[model samples]
Target: MADINIQRKKSSPSPWLLILLVLLGLAAVGYYVFRADSDQPVTTAPAVPSPEPAPDSTTGAETAPRPTNDPAVADMATEEPGGSPDELAAFAASDASAPNYGRRGLEMLMASLRPLADRDDLRDATVSEKRDDLTSATSRLQEQGTSLRPGYVAAANLIKAMQQKAYPALEADAGELVNRANALSGRTNTAQEQQQVRDFLSRAAEIVRALNQPAQ
Candidate 1:
């Protein structure tokens, strides 16, 4: 038997197998990157709050109104002046005891005289000293009429008629005027009002008597 030593050759792996292994490794890496991206939460902008509205300027508390003794005068202060003289006179005659009767009565009496005062005949006479008594009485009556009762206004009307030289009309209306004065006197409660009405009646009677007497 001959002593002979023999060595066997070792085989290397195929190139195709090495290539397949490298491709598999790359696919694993790509899959892991895609999975990480899918699992990550998306960031967004935060929400903002709206601003509140301001309060109104005119919504504050207001002051209370003042008290009044005469409600009609208070109401009249706020109302615009209107109505015809005849209409006011009608109201005066009908509503003699009403709260605004003073105003209505004064207006009725003034309506007759104001036109006469403005007339061409009376324009010069109104300012004359000869008419001083008449002018003074009416001026005071006018001043007091706003607060005084209707009886005073009725009395003033007679004086006004006499001053205007409307004697025939005054005489014609004398009975009616006296009747009205008497009725008004009965309606008044105060002693002063009664005394005034009495004076008015006496003056009215004297005037009627003087008119009936022949002029000297």
Candidate 2:
């Protein structure tokens, strides 16, 4: 045997072993990154709720109930008085009793007519005075038609005719006006309403008759 001793070089890792170690190291690193990410708290946002619906305006459903039975309350509900001119006239002309509202309206019209007819100088009456009388009578008569009931349409026409005429001309039409008033009386349910209409006719007649009497 030669004196040279066979010395074994220190063994190096095989290429396959190095590759396996590198793959293991990479896998450990990936696992650690995944575990770190997983350890943190998962924050999810809370869900938002939808809004509620609004109420209606026109019906006033949310408000307290109104008192329909009370007269004062009923009056408060409407801005204008009830009854129509035609209906009021028809009612007055009918055998059925005129509603309190219409009956009262007749009384008011008669009141205004009385002063105009009873005037000593009706034919010679100033146009201003005649206009005032016209205004008062027409306003009251018009009110009869306001509350949704038929109003004194017939009587309103008579009033309108009177308003269109001169004092002397109105005096000439008084007889015809009287006829209209009497016609209104025939439609009334109550003696009082009829009598009121008659009184108005009588005053209209007086106005006409006085016009013929030559200034006293």
Best by TM-score: 1
| TM-score of each model, paired residue for residue | 0.32, 0.30
Per-candidate RMSD, Å: 13.5, 12.9
| Deviation from native of the Cα of residue 118 in model 1, angstroms | 2.5
Which ten contiguous residues of candidate 1 have the minimum total lDDT? 126-135
lDDT of 2 at 186: 33
lDDT string, candidate 2, 107-202, tens digits: 434344433334455434443355344334444443433331122333334443343443445544555564555455334456775655545434
In angstroms, give how far residue 3 of model 1 lies from its true place. 99
lDDT of each: 0.47, 0.47
Clashes of 1: 0
lDDT of 2 at 62: 60
Clashing pairs in 1: none
